[model samples]
Target: MTTLLAARSDRPVQFLWGTNVLVEEAALQDIVRDDVRLPEAGPTCEDLAPARFVTNPAALEEVFLAGMNAVARMDGAPPITSVVVRIQGWREGHGIPAAAESSPYVGWCCLFATPAPSTAESGCLSLADPRAGSDLTAMPGLPWGRQVLIRPVPGALAIAPGWLTHSVVPIEHGQQLVMAVATCSR
Candidate 1:
């Protein structure tokens, strides 16, 4: 029998997941429209949204900070150094495939898989088993055997360690929007 332990760190992976209405739809729309223009491409998701980046919209910063605090508490307080923000979009045919990898930052905040009011299918997040070998950590965009797709709630924030390999599942229908925040500590 494949026994699964419910202990926090002993599990295949560990992450902070919560739902809070922190940002508004209108605000989110504006952020995407007026604020997403980056001088250059963001960190590779393919370091992240710059290795350290935040939302141009102040309203979204509060939401990101809240997530940072939660992840910080889980980890004994570390001095945060930088933050980066970016918006990721997905449609029926185009989506980022999963891989076995982790981030280079101290923590990351992502509002993954936003709902498509016009569609019924929900996109899911496939996270690799934390217990897997380190080889998996560097090879992102490639799928592994042990991973799971998690459905995300709009307005809910997912704050997790920088080293957990995760990716968005192929969106079968409609569009999926995401607000990504990456942070570093020194």
Candidate 2:
């Protein structure tokens, strides 16, 4: 069974995580094969298949719905009217630079062949504190000033607000794959 987890903060930033999502082996192989065939050096999203490429599209959609509902409930944000789904692959030493989504929300599902090793936060999603000037203080019992790291485990999904600044830690060894979903309110 799939389970959804949420990381709530006193600040505005929040993250939703889904675990135990099921994807067919064939689908996984197809995505990896296509990624390997591509010639891009850094993270590549071009020519990737749509969300339908996944054998079980409903599983991912569930995560998306949960994220949308969370945003609506907590932030009282507008409903998401559209979403752009893409498959992204990262090779060794390649990682996404820190950036915020232009849309209202963003979701990602790790499709790696294996879980990233725990050392040095390999292939982990890193989220920065959204509050400005929070880094200036070093106090106990404070959520700000520390980054939230989400390890890369196959079938693990994460969703966060678009305004949240986030990036991926470069993998030291193997390739890292993920399905990215961006949501629009308009």
Overall lDDT per candidate, in order of appearance? 0.43, 0.55
What TM-score, to 2 decimals, does candidate 1 have?
Answer: 0.50
**lDDT of candidate 1 over 45-124, digit per residue (tens):** 33225222333445565555555655666456664444545545444554455443244332223444434434333455
Q: Candidate 2 at 186: error in angstroms?
A: 4.1
RMSD of candidates 1 onward, in order: 9.6, 8.6
Best by TM-score: 2
Candidate 1 deviant stretches above 4 angstroms = 1-56, 100-122, 133-148
Q: Give per-residue CA lDDT, model 2, range 66-142, as digits (tens).
A: 66656655665566655555666555675778888887777776665343455658777876645433232453222
* Top candidate by lDDT: 2
